[model samples]
Structures are given as C-alpha cells and as structure tokens.
Target: MLSRMKGSKILITGASSGIGKAVAFELARRGVKLTLASRRLDSLRDVVEEIQSAFPEAPQPLIARCDVTRRKDVKRMVEECVRRFGGIDVLINNAGTGVYGNAEFTAIEDFRAVMEVNFFGAVRCMMEALPFLKQAEKGLVINITSVAAKHGVPYLGAYGASKAALAVFSQSFRSELKESGVSLMIVYPSYTQTDFFRNEKKVGGARRPRGPYASPQKVARAIVRAAESGKRNLVLSLEGKALTFSQGVFPRLVERAMDRIAYKLREKQEVFNE
Candidate 1:
C-alpha cells in the first residue's frame, strides 16, 4: 500500500503556476521532498523561495527546467530527481494546453500542438518515471485531466479530446500495472480558476469567460490526497461528478442538453459553435 502523508519524494510538472504551484505548497506542508519541473526556471525559483521560507527545516526543493513535450527533457528531469531525492515516490503529470475552435476552422497544427503537450507529454513523463517508480516500494502517478473528457464542451473539442485520450490511457495503464507497486491516478477537474484561458489560444470565436470554476488550491489538494491514498481516479467538484453521472445514465439526453445550453449561451456572443 502507498504510504500516507509525507517523507516521500514527489515530482510535479507544470509547477511554475496555478494547480502545480498550489500542490507544491500542499505537499510541503505534508513534509514531502519535492522536485518541481516546468519550462520557466524563474517561476520555479519563486515557488522554491516561498516554500523554503515556509518550511526552513525541510530539504530545499530541486528545480528543473523542462518542457514535458520533449521526451529527452522528461527523461533527464526524472533522472535528476532520482539522483537528488534517491527515487520518486510520486509523479504528477499536470502539464497541458487548451485549443478552442470548430473542427473545420481549427488549425491542424494547433490541435496537434494541444495533443503533443496534453497527451504525449504525459505519456513521455510517465514512461520516464516508470523505472524510478518501479524501484520504489510504493509509487503513484497522477495525470491532471478535465471534465471535458466526459462531456463535450463547445470550442474545446481539441482540448477535450486530448484529455479524453489521457483518461483512456490512464485506465489502461492502471490495469496493466495492477500487480506492480506503482499506482496510477487520473483526475478530471471541471472549470478551474487558473490562467488556463489566458494561456490558451482562442480561435473562431470570442472567448467566453466562465464562472463557478473550482479553485486551483482545491484541485491541488485533491491531487495530493489521491497521490497519498493511491486513488485510481478522481473527478474534482460536484459539478464534474454530476455531469459525468448524467453522461453515464442518459448519454444522448445529456449530450443534447449540453448542446442546447451551449447554443443558447453562445448564440448572441458568437463565442462558440458545436
């Protein structure tokens, strides 16, 4: 069984900001030694500084500059973490991107970019971490996905598709590693309060701001909880759970309801089309 709480070595990608950064803090409080990886070294330094100040007695966090889309970078990053902390007990694949537009209007290059970062990136990280995970007496992998994996969202088809693939991949991975010491977890978060929209590329419509979004801190806490408990899958927020259940119980009905809602919401704004 995966041990609860801290004293384990944990690594998180996309650690520069938002959910990844919040998770770093959450794990810090639990006393886990962390290796934070992202493309931005400056942002990573800031997070390290904050955590160092908060937990002066704990080991200083190891910071790595990595773009998970690159397999070589991910391999090196995992190797470095293993070298520093001995071996990884938890690996959180949280880096992803969103692309918005109709399928016809969406650029093929943009959709590919989303898949590379959101899907293949997680795949590479998982592969790179596998050996270290296997070496550990207990290991966990958490992939941060979205509710779009279950219900299609307007103009978020590419983003949703990427997450859907990750969810499926995680399910297969979980079963494949059933007898192994490593645990696999995939998380589906509903809209969350992050810079996701600002960072995303908007195409074929005006970006419609959304409300009732979950907080990054809340999502981060869920991730840490899943990692500690060795949960197989987690859907964050009541809204996400309800929507997923609707999809399961009444697939066509839920799809039609979502289609109607999207049309009504975006009709006047020209913000999206299914």
Candidate 2:
C-alpha cells in the first residue's frame, strides 16, 4: 500500500490545519505528490514548508488558497492541481465548518452557512474533480464526515444535519461512480481533538460535548489506510463505531443520552462563563 501511495498525486482541501494538515504530512512522508488547498494561504504555506522540511526528498507540495463555498475557487483549485500534478489520483474533501446550538436557538442562516461549507463544499470539489479522478488508474474520493451525521447529537443539530446530507450524498455518489472506476470513501470520526470547536460559528450558548477525543493524526491515518485499501467506508475510533451501532439498535436511547450529555455540557459552560 505504501509503495502504491508513493508517487501518487493527491489533493486535499482544508489543508491548513487539523486532520487535513496531518494527512498532508502523513502522505508526504510516504512520498506522495500533493496539492494542498485552503482558505488561508499563510497557514497553507506554513504546512507546505513543514512538509518540505520533514520530507526533503518528497515532491514539493503545491498550495492554493481556496474557499470551498465558492464554485469558481473550487474550479480553479482543481485546475491548478491538475496543471501541476498532471492528474489527481485522490481527492480528499476535508474542508468543513460547523455551527453549534440547539435547533430552536440556532438561526436558519447559521444552518445555511454550515451546509454551504460542510455539504456543498464537498459536493463542489467532488464534481470538479470527477473528470480528473476518472482518468486516474485507481481514482479515490474521500469525504470526511462525522459520526454526528449518523446520530444527530444534541447541541450540534445544524452541524449534524450538514454532515448527514454529505454522508447521504457520498453514499449515492459512490454507487454512481461504481462503473466509472472512481471510488468514493466516506469517513466518520467522532470528537476529534482539533480546533474545529474553537473555530465553529457559535449561534447559541452551547458548549462542546466532553469526551475522549481522537487525535487528528489518528483520524488522518485511518483515512489514508482506507484510501490505500480501496475501503468503501471508515468510522474511526471504537467509541465512534459504538455510537453508530447503538444509534441503529436503540435510536431513542442514544438520542436521550446525547441530550443529557449536551445539557450537562451547556450547564458547565454557563458556570464557566459566570
């Protein structure tokens, strides 16, 4: 798998930080040529420099400042990647944003904004990269969704909805690409320890749920492994898998548990603020 990964041309969105940055480094170490895209050029450059420094022998990664919400930006990013790498063997749609609040408290605009980034962003990237992906020997598209999508967690309703939409789209598109030889992989990770919470657009006074969080590096490794093995889907962490399974087996029970946890966290946040 490592041998196959070496020299593969890959493109990653949200490459400025968190899981995307970790994945960039992981792939660079394996000698994959990369095109890293994000909204912040400065941070993206920092990531590129770090990768180049660590893997001096690896191909110098291409960087593009792309806001996935914009169709033009998405198109240009894909074009730049294709121009530099010849073709993209793997497209990782990892760019996403979140909004935190209860359903009644979160504004509709906040929901839209989250969907624009989390769901539509991945959609745009997938559509733009489909052509290049089709031309590859073993094309792969990996969408970084969340376990929240599978079980609509309280206080994260809007974010969960956006990811759920993306997850469903990934499933349907995977079937559509069945004959095209372009594989689509959906990744579900739970409570990853990243700046995701800090960067979230907070609509109401909801707090992040407390839990044993997975590292960005661990999630990135799972993503790369799934891509290399042509795995169709991956739900990272044992707790994530359990949550997904429990949701299926006992929906109401899981929902109630999530609500209680959210209540406790929100109370804790209120106390901290006080």
Give the 10-residue window scoring lowest on summed lDDT in candidate 1. Answer: 265-274
On residues 1-274, what C-alpha lDDT tens digit does candidate 2 reach at each position? 3357579999999999999999999899888989999999999999988998899999999999899999999999999999998999999999988887666766788889999999999999999999999999888898999988888777778899999999999999999999998888899988888899899976655556556888999888888887778788899888788898888899888979987877687677731222
What local lDDT score does residue 139 receive in model 2, on the 0 to 100 scale?
88
TM-score to true structure, per model: 0.95, 0.94
TM-score of 2: 0.94
Q: What is the lDDT for 2 in model 1?
A: 29
Q: Each candidate's lDDT (Cα)?
A: 0.85, 0.87
Indicate which candidate wins on lDDT.
Answer: 2
Q: In model 1, which runs have C-alpha deviations exceeding 4 angstroms?
A: 1-5, 272-274
Residue-wise lDDT of candidate 1 within 1-274, one digit each (tens)?
2236358898999999988999998888878889999999999999999999998877789999999988789988998999998999888898877887666678889889999999999999999899888888777888899998988887778999999999999999989987887888889988888888888888876565567888998888887777666677789888789888988898988889878866765776656543
10 residues in a row with least lDDT, candidate 2? 265-274
**Model 2 segments more than 4 A misplaced:** 1-3, 266-274
